[model samples]
Target: MIIAVIGAGYVGLITALCLAKIGKSVICFDMQTDKIESLKNGIAPFLEPGLPELLQEATNSGKVKFTSNINDLKDSSIAFVCVGTPNDPKTGSSDLSYLYSAIESLENVLSQSSTIVIKSTVPIGTGEDIYKKYPKKLSFASCPEFLREGSAIYDFMNPERIIIGTRNDQDKSRIIDIFGYFKDKAEFVHTNVTTAEMIKYAANSFLAMKVGFINEMARLCDSFDANIKDVSLGIGLDSRIGKAFLNPGPGFGGSCFPKDVKALSTTAQNHAKELPIINNILVSNQMHKEYLADFIVKIAQKYNQNNIGILGVTFKANTDDMRDSASLTILPMLKSKGLNAIIYDPAYTNSKPKELDNFNFVNNLQGVLDSTKIIVVLTEWSEFKGLNFNSDAIIIDFRNIYCISDMQKQNIKYYNLGRLNEGAN
Candidate 1:
């Protein structure tokens, strides 16, 4: 089967490469000529583990093709719309401009009875709207992607559930057949297009809420001189609470959680419904960012230092994505307070956050530590786990990468979230 994936960004590239790995011929379409050329050379535009190897193998086997032309999708029976739906700054809603452009570009090129899958995270009713605008012979399905940024390849191969949202039975059957490669790997859920769209928003918002709730608890733990790690362990053992998203960190910041939570809240407001929990989640997360920034400022004042070292800038470990990262907010807050920061990340390869255009970014971990007085671990990168700290240097760990007992044994002054007494050893 010939499958075409549009918008060769993270989701589009991963989807195209993974599908090709399953022995299906795939044509990946993108507007960026450079990105297409990079993919054709087996070079991924972003840093994702296991993707380059799979892409190279797929290209070498003649199973995958990358092109910037929309006409390249003419022979594809199934075209997945994996374009981005970034949050609109003005409306605080998901911007579907890219999605619309992708669809319009392929309007004349796609086969008469082709099946179009909406893999992008979008507002509800988008699939229905597309179905209404397109030809009746063309089938539309809302199969929202649930792949995590760092572990996208693994998630694609081993999804928990596969959702196929379409009104037509034939379309559903054909879509199922397309994903028949994963029949035993995942459970297939069939639903209407709108419901499928809502599922993505609902899942992301709920997960954001969980992260917010735990961060709130971490704050309380700090106040009460209690340990948050033990609390998380206790609650997570209940089976109902689950261990996922329970770890306390510098709030949730990624491509999905922040944008999806805001989009869901905005959607609720448009319907004349109030979502206090959702609204509070956003507020709490923002407050937590400020709180962490303030904590850094206080530490700098106590240590009589103006320079601070930041260990990681990416929102989370394993990916170089810095979208909405805590560093973006915290670093600006610190700068406003007349504090200097030297930042380093293992994944920092020429991709600096636009917000920190003038900020100092170091390529080596030792460079960040040698020039700064205090170390602040923002993203929990694996290399940071084996780091040797200076005994006199104060370490503020937002991700809780090190244990209090270990830091105390080394007589290292450390502060971590959900720990008591600000980690004074």
Candidate 2:
């Protein structure tokens, strides 16, 4: 099958590469010329564990081609739309401008037998609306992607469920054919377009809630002088909780959870309905970020040190995605109170984000080690584990990557979430 994958962003590119890896001929298109050029040379603009290898294999096999021209995709029978629906921080609503653009662009080239599979996470009833808009020839199906950033390749190859949301069996079968080898990876959920759209939001919202719930409990643990790890283990062992997103940290931030939760809440508000839990997830998350900043600043001031050390900046480990990391908010807050940080993360050794131009970054772990005052571990990268540090340094392990006993043996004061930071008081 000649597969046309649209919008070559994180999800789209992964979709294209994976389809190519499955031995299907793919033509991936993106409006961004720079991105298209990079993909043509087998270089992924973003970081994923197994992407480079996959890109190399696909490129060598000549199964996938990247292009900026839309005409290159005209001959494909199946088109997967993987554009992003970025959420506005101020309005807490998703901007579907990119999705609309991709569809309009696809409409010009899509054939009568072509099935437009919508893989982007959109608001409910979007599939039906798009079908109505182009009812002449193109058939629509909502096949929302649930791929995680760091492990996108693995997740793509082994999804827990494959959702095909279309009222038409013909449309559903066409979407199913696109996942030829992956149909047995999990259950094939055939449902109406609305139900499939709601499933994506519901899954992300619930996961975000799990993250929020654990973080809130960590706060309570802090107040009561309790250990949150034990609490998490006990609560998570329950069959009901099942223990997936229960890890306590600064908070949850990524492409999916934050945006999807906000969109779901915003959708409720637009319909003049209320979702108390969904609405307050963002509020509570922001509050936690602020509280963490306050805690770090208060504790760091005792040493009267102006320079602090940061271990990670990306949202979480194994990928270079820094869309909404807690370190972005917390580090700036520390700066406002007169503290400078030297950061080192495995992801940003060669390149640095221009948005963080104000802060200083080092290319190696030893650079951050130069500052012995206080070291804040932000993202929980595996490289930061089991490392020796200066004996006089103070450690604030935000992601719980360090051992409290090891810190005590070295006579370094250690503070972790929910274990109680006596230094803050």
Candidate 3:
């Protein structure tokens, strides 16, 4: 089967590569000429674990191809819309400019009776709107992708469930057949298109709420002199609560959770409905970044130094995406207080970090630590897990990289987001 994936971003690239590995021919369409040129040379625009190898293998095998021309989507049996729907500045709602553009572009070239799948995260009722736009000539379905960064290929290949929402039985059957490429590996759930769209936003918002709830607990624990790790462990052991997304950090900052949560809340308010939990989740995460900034400021004030070292700059480990990263928010707060923060991320390449202002980027770990008075473990990379803490240098381990026992044994003054410090021996 021939599949065309629009927008060679994280979702588009990962989906196209994975589907090609399963013997399907894929054409990845993007508007950026440079990105397409890079892909043709076997270079991925962004750094993702295992994607480079997979993309190279697919290209070598003649299974996958990349092009900037929309004409390349012709003769494709299935078209997947994976373009970005970034958050808007005005209303915090999801901006669908890219999505609308993609549809209009496809409408000009799409073959009659072609199936279009929406893999991008959109608000509820978006599927119905898209279905209305194309009418009977084109088959539309909302097959919202549930893949995470850093592990996107694995998640796509081994999805927990594949949900396809269609209004008609014929459309549903065609959708199921296309997904038959999975060969019973994934559980298929069929529902109305609106429900499928809602699932993506709902799932992302729930995870965001969980992070905010734990961070709030961490704040109260700090005030009462209690250990949050112990409390979280006790609660997480319950089968009902499950321990994922329980670890608190500077805040939840990534492409999906932050944007989707706000979009979902905005959608609810538009209909005169109340979503206090969702609204609070967004506000609480913002405050969490400020709290982390204040924590670092307090440590910097003690030494009377204006320089601070940041260990990791990305949102999470194993991925180099810095979009909406908590460090971006927290760094500005520190700079406003007269602290010039130096950042060191091993994956900092091809992107200019100097343009961010009030911050200096270092390529080496030792260089950042040597020049600054204190170290802030922001992203929780595995390399930061076993650092020597015996030095008198103050450290604020925001992602809980150091255990309380080890920090005390090494006499390291450390503070974490959720866990209380055991104090230096």
Candidate 4:
């Protein structure tokens, strides 16, 4: 069957490429001429592992094609709308403009009775609202994506569960057949559209809570002189509290967590209810970033160093996304305190972002090592794992990439997230 994948952004591109991988004849359509041109040349706009290779293979096999013209999607029977639903700044609810716009664009070219699957994360009740508007023109299904940024390809191929939210049995079966390879291993969850939408919001908010809870524990560990890593291990072994999303990092900053958490909270509030726990997740995460900034300032003051070296800037490693990274918050705080930041991220070797236009950007890791004696490890990239530093450097390992034991042997002073034995020989 010829399937049309809408939008070519991060999730859209991943969806289109993975759909092609599953032997579907995919026509991936986007409005941007530049993005379509790049895809035609096998160049993905964003850095995702295994995506470029997959794109090349799929295009070479004549299974997929990218196009700027919407009419290219004329013959497609199934249209998967993978457009973005970013949170609206004013309402803290999702801006459905992109979702609505994608539908309007599809309405122009999609064949009558074509099935439209929403792969984007949207607010609850969106399905019912859409069905009321386009009942005869199309068939609707809510099949939200749960792919992570770095491991998107693997997650798509081996999903833990594939939720197909539709009342129609034929619609469900046909959609399930699109991902037929997953039936052997993945659970096929059947739900109404509203329930499926709630599931996405619930899952993302819960993961965000785990991150906020751990960071809060890490702060308590700081006060009590305890090791959070050991505490994490202790709680994670209970089986109820699995060791996922338990890593203590700067903050939860990606496209999904921050946006979904806020959108869910706003949704609850709209229903005349209060979600204190969900509300506190965002509050706690923001406080965590500010707390880390204050801690770093105190460290810089103790070391008497105005020039601080920043190791990484991306939210996490392996992808070049900086949507809601804590670096965006923490770096500006340091600059406001008159501290000079010398930042180096492997992703930004070509050029730095305009948000960080004021801070000095170094082309290499060695540039950061040479310019400052005080260093702060922000994002834990793979390249920073085995880095060797010499001389008397004071390092604050936020992501805890460096070993405290090894730091002492090298005569470098190091601090990490509540590891009590960081000082001893």
Model 1 per-residue lDDT tens digits across residues 396-425: 989998988888998988888988855331
Model 3 misplacement above 4 A: 134-137, 181-184, 349-351, 422-425
Deviating ranges (above 4 Å) for candidate 2: 135-137, 420-423
What's the lDDT for all of these models? 0.88, 0.87, 0.84, 0.88
Residue 152 displacement (Å), model 1: 0.8
The alpha-carbon lDDT assigned to residue 92 of candidate 4 equals 98
Clash count in backbone of candidate 4 = 0
Q: Give a tens-digit lDDT track for model 2, residues 94-204.
A: 888898899998888877878888899999988888888774658888888998988899999998899889878888877777776886678899998899999999999
Which residue pairs collide in model 4, if any? Answer: none
Q: Least accurate stretch of 10 residues (summed lDDT) in model 4? A: 416-425
Candidate no. 1 TM-score: 0.97
Question: Between 2 and 3, whose TM-score is larger?
Answer: 2
lDDT of 3 by residue, 47-87 (tens): 78898899899999899999999988878877899999999
TM-score of each: 0.97, 0.97, 0.95, 0.97
Candidate 1 least-lDDT 10 residues: 416-425
For model 3 the local lDDT of residue 206 reads: 93
Candidate 1 segments whose C-alpha is farther than 4 A from its true place: 135-137, 349-351, 423-425
